[model samples]
Target: MSAVAHAQGHAGQGSQALAPADPLPITGGTFKPTADSLKTYQTPAWFRDAKFGIWAHWGPQAVPRSGDWYARFMYVPGHPHYAHHLKHYGHPSERGYKDILPLWKAEKFDPEALMDLYVAAGAKYFVSMGVHHDNFDLWKSRHHRWNALAMGPRRDIVGAWRDAARRRGMRFGVSEHLGASHNWFYPSHQYDQFWPKMGADYDGADPQYADLYHPKHDEPFKGNPDTWYTTDPAFHKIWFNRIRDLVDSYEPDLLYSDGGLPFGEVGRSLVAHYYNSSIAKHGGVDVVYNCKALGSGEFYPEACVQDVERGVMSGINPLPWQTDTSNGDWFFTDGDTYKTAPDVIRMLADIVSKNGNLLLNVALYPEGNLPPESQTLLSELAHWMGTNAEAIHGTRPWAVYGEGPTETTAGAFKESAAYTAQDIRFTTKGDALYAITLGEPRGRVTIAALGRNAGHERRAVQSVRLLGVAEPLQFQQTDAALVIDLPARMPTRHASAFRIAFGA
Candidate 1:
């Protein structure tokens, strides 16, 4: 048998009896369920040049304004969210996540308005949460009955967002966090230890709700194991069917898995299917597949875009990557502190200089409106992007990432680093180079990377000007550093950009 045929035989062995209503249009490709097959993958140019994206990590979890992992966290007795749930609603034994679904009406969700703000804020692409670990589908699913259309919102949230994005000429993508759900929801089956009379079995013990809870009555509920995802073949099959349907319905330009490629060969098959489907739709493969690099041999940098959850790289990365971060908590939390506009701009410049993209999630209240502070941050970003976008969009990394004293800690969840005025990041476009100062330079700005005798300098600097300012600035190139005199007044409030022109 051929490699493709052999792979199909392996996938067919007890892999979800459920198949999509329509057959997948996989016409041509040698991408099979194997490491060698995936190694042939390559990232698209559209993603490499598009340096900024906005993500709506919004979902039913926002209904309570209670922060992230609410679905799982609410069942744990000691968690603050669980206490909030007990006070507002009843105990989990009476009310569960299923009961919280109807409250997420998304009554004020206006995708067009949000997309316009994102476009002005320099977002080249937009991503929607197809499903989080909550297992509630945001799109209208052919197989799953628990979705936005059937319940809370009574609307296809994903479809609406995609329409708005298409109208604005922005690429649309989706994120699936469902792979880790099996073990994530284990707490729902246990009863509270502190409360006396309320210590009855939670609603997850009912067999009627087993489809949603997936608890085996004969087995004991081991509340929250150190292991994250389940190793069950049955759950893998279910994931395969739901995710396949998501891909077939929306046909997104990009797909991101919250974890690494899941379920071994089953995950590889889905990835192959995604690439093939995109090739059929767009003539060639213009799609991107993003996943976390969990140090498994399966996640190769050449095959897909490596995503940092809430962090950045220290230096320039040869392959294009992405940083998925948020303004505050993943879900909207009441009275949560948010990142400043300058913080977002600085991170963007740093990531772009390292040949990476920034996918920022702006939190939205349960009613679907942004927080007042988030709105202010967006306005600030729009102003900065309007003038200095030429330095960001469609630019490549410089020979060096940047010159700086304050270095960002390189890893996931290490994004809260405080940058200074001396810290600078660089990007190049043809004959021009953009140097972004993390803060307002008070006196003179000296760039050692562009010094006269430094081999890093590509060509002689002819002139220098601030991005938003029209007047050219005075500069002196020496063996030690290229120093530029600044105007008495600053051009912008946030991070400033300086455009250095080079002669041929």
Candidate 2:
């Protein structure tokens, strides 16, 4: 079967067995705040004002030659990464993820310098990985002994990043991929189709790393073949406790979960704790939560934002949402290809135009520093943001978000055909309207959709100016459309924006 078919089959079986209830629960003090409620949730002014963010997907997984889906690779039989794991470390049973922690030497990590670079690259906020499914905390946690400071790195990773981000005048946040930890880690317990072929030493009989792998308990692994990890009640409690400690200790400006909200009631309690803690810290209400799963009817409706992965929504909503995507794989791999700077800039403009914030992009640094190619991309992005920032930051969707020939779907992880010259995305800042061209127009560009019928006249184009050019350009308005003359040569290589001043 194709990967898509496989995914669909997996989804069908999973949903058939378990019907997920309305994940959103109404907690006593947690009242749902709409966009209008004085207490109603409004996208935090800061998040709206600061349109772009960068995420650091660093963790113990970086220690190995394997990739981001280490949790999954441990189970897949005869896969290249699986084979690498067997040859290099033994089997999933022995030399498991916990044993890999000691090998993670983030020796070159410099949070201050990294945050400075991210800020220069035009990231308004920084998201540091708090804990991935590997169950290692990147912070100085009082709850979990298996943390960065206590183990491999021997430094408070999150705290350092937070301090650096704050010093650079950027909002700081943490990402918790621990929600599915219980299920994602299940494969470690059972002997998979490939497990039997492993040599005697490859069996998970090693006692030294038992704490890391969580020695098998009495519970029977469940119905889902796709769920690799076992969920022990005791381990679940520890998960919640560790996350609670993270929220309380850090009081992050934003909190991101890998999956939607946490798994069970334990997860809900953690969310409640995060909301309450934010209120307590900011003195009434201050922080924002970004969850994959959005809940309804809560005191802190505005307290959280929805995170869409690599996709833009069709229409604008009063509430703000974010798109989190990476330039390449989440973890740095030797042969990985990366998205170009233009691709990054275009994505940012497109996402912002569609009434969403782009947690724009990230590239993992295996050696604790950005590779030269990644650094070059960041520099180019900074230049792009510098020129077209007004069209991006602090802007909302205009009446209709521009006319375009190539339309992208409002679904998750959808890749679009390359946008053509006819495609233009629209955004507004104060009284100014920005029409960003996805591709360069050959002669003159005409926006016929802006006629009087659309409640705006062609005369509304008071003054037209190309973003990267110095002088204003000549333009004319007919009854149907506004047309602007172009320079003999385009100013920028890829996409460009035009600034239109209008009298409202």
Candidate 3:
């Protein structure tokens, strides 16, 4: 995932027995565990209007303070995390990921404090990690003992986050990356390639720790992405039960799967159960399920909200979607580069213009606190949002997304090129049309899409004003374009939004 944070539950007891595979857990509501039934899913308005969310991708992996895949990469021969782990925590044969779990004592983690910061930064929702690819649960997990409550911080990370978000009336969500954990942890089973203990099996080879490392599977050095998900039915059942407990316990407003619907039928059943439970919990179909289901980077609004990981869509989508990215790496890295406040603002405006939400992860250290740079970034975002949030929240994509030369590269994992003053995005709320410039415009600017003769939009603009400015702007609408004269000074440095009111 190459994120800024990583995973860790905690340590106290022996591994619990894997629960026997059973039928889908929440089969009571209207939806069934079939693709056809799920096809009728409708994205909730709360989610669509909420637009932006903050995520806590933080976990034990941050204990290493290195970037992503610490648990797995630490066992590899040549990866950077391997070297870092070797230097600090010894070789995998001696000190494996299991040892890193205890180091994550979230003494500084205050969910309410972080939630307040996010709310100020214009986040309408919050997502907590239920379990990460390292297969550690952030909640009180029943499937296995390794969890936030059982081991690492010995606190219910998910519960605390959920309570914090709910206290502030922000919607709550959970992300489960356990589908690929079985294969992701395969490296732990192998030995160091070149070392004082070259062929010695890592701790993962021991039978007693199988529950934490997963039962020994073939070393998965295959570069293919498919290999990430194994075909073990028992593992699927385990995933189902753990996630079911997560859903039933939290009854989250949204549920996110790291990858596409996992294990087919089992995944579908879980979605159905989630939808059913969500209806009962909220008294309507007010829940959203996000998955990276299609390989083509297409959004399946019919089944679930499409989630593009670390990237964005090429253009406006017909239905609501999301781009889950981070200000820095997924997990916290000691010397990581963070996205600038302007960069984030531009991305948020671009994403919202394309009918997508931005779920930004603010990387946190193992101590459960944000770095000063992150706090400053959030402050910048809060300032910008204070003036321009009306253009973002509760708005839909305009007839045309916008007139912009800067285009976000299509598909997942691509962060897109930098935007320019020429790049513009559009959003609409009732009779108000918002034209958002990704960069600080010069003294004057022209928008061809708003031209009177433009075929896409023929609405007559009655008045025009900048979002934060008190005075109405001077503008002329013609067949060629709508040209507006700008004030010498703009309110925000990140982006400028012009609100055009259309009269009947």
Candidate 4:
């Protein structure tokens, strides 16, 4: 159906204020605000080959180091974060979130240094959080006055990230979680029922700051199913305008929405405008759009990239996809146990073998420097990537993902798994195949998938060499299995990679 028709069909579900508007007149290509037209869109080659990326999920919320959703969660009367806020920053009515904004100075923010570390850590792309559900824009947004330039830090956060990524020759991306802001921030407008001063109004209820706090919603969103996105047409239009400003200004290589394509027709129009704008700039589209809604069928086959949050696909996907995960919490939270380097390497190997990229979010502290643990993690990742990067970058999924005893649950928020030496993943480029061992094998390792006696016809295995190791692998390929002798000492502390060459 046409975009207008689709809008009409779903109009009853949302406010009547969201009637279809004229499509934005983009200069370059013939992209209409319709599902059929967007079906012609294709994934960029740059995105397919760039297997790993780094995301700075940094913002004012990191200031307290109280973890994700601190802005909204702090307002809930009995929540621990609320007590923390009360103890530290006074009551919500007096020194609420609006007062907390000035404290996020980002005094030590150095994008260039961070970008250099990310480059060494083998990130081909860098994504900056344009805004979070706190309703704070990190960029120099013309549409929203409550942005980085207008408030705390007094710097163009997105522009700085873009410049650094460009200097490092990495593709730039921006993630927008603003689509869910209206409902997410609804708690701010509420009065605490069980506080020291019962029923005292929070700063959000003040009409003077409604733009930043968002206009008050009558219904509370504590356990509401529709809290993810707002049905209010005014907020939808505001969302479109803000995101449109982001696209028109930054022209990032990738645009990621924290949720699905937002308010149907309006969202489609923004995406079409993004593609058309990219065509105007680069003469051909070198852009990618990612959203976290699976099986919606709202996205066409080649229209955009699919993103799994903190999870992986079960096997090789027909089209390229990405997994956006963080080392710890999405935002910086004090006393959180982070993923070890070995765990990260294992995840990367598994993700790459499944025709998917891993966009790792290295959580930055409010002061803008990495914690000691995070710094060490990056250093270890860089060391591992330094040796086995050839096996990852520009490689496609092999015939089989791998021969593994352990498999992660295939869905969002399922990043926890214990991988053994038996867990192996495969990727290929031309005649060379990469077999990555998730952990160090005790003795000789055997790959049953490459055996001549496999379920299907197997390729002839010619020779094998371990990446970063000077010595060649002692191996034999039989009809039963392909066995290789492992050395006494591991080349790296993390996952090991082997380049197995095949014969015609």
For 17-111, candidate 3 gives per-residue lDDT tens digits of 23236665575888887667888999989999999999999899999888888898888787898889889998788889999998899999999
Ranking by lDDT, best first?
Answer: 3, 4, 1, 2
In model 2, what lDDT does residue 49 have? 75
lDDT of 2 by residue, 236-272 (tens): 5666667777877887888887544444445545666
lDDT (10s digit) by residue, model 4, range 124-227: 99999999888899988988888999889999999999999998899999999887677668778889797367989988999998998899885333443334
What is candidate 1's lDDT per residue for 1-504, written digit by digit as tens?
011111111111122222333433443475766667777888889998899999999999998888888888788888998999988878888898889999999999999999999999999999999998888999999877889999999999999999999999999999998876765677778887874736687777677776677765322244422234455667777888899899889989989987566666667778888887777777677889997764221466677798887889989998999999999988999889899999999999999999999999998998788899889989999999999999999999999999889968997777876888889999998788999998878889999999977789767899999888889999999888889999888868778899999876
Give each model a TM-score: 0.92, 0.85, 0.94, 0.93
Instruction: Give candidate 3 misplaced runs (Cα > 4 Å).
Output: 2-22, 219-225, 294-301
lDDT against the true structure, per candidate, is 0.82, 0.67, 0.84, 0.83
Query: What is the overall TM-score of model 2 with all chains considered together?
Result: 0.85
Clashing pairs in 4: none
**Model 1 root-mean-square deviation:** 6.0
RMSD to truth, every model: 6.0, 5.0, 5.2, 4.4
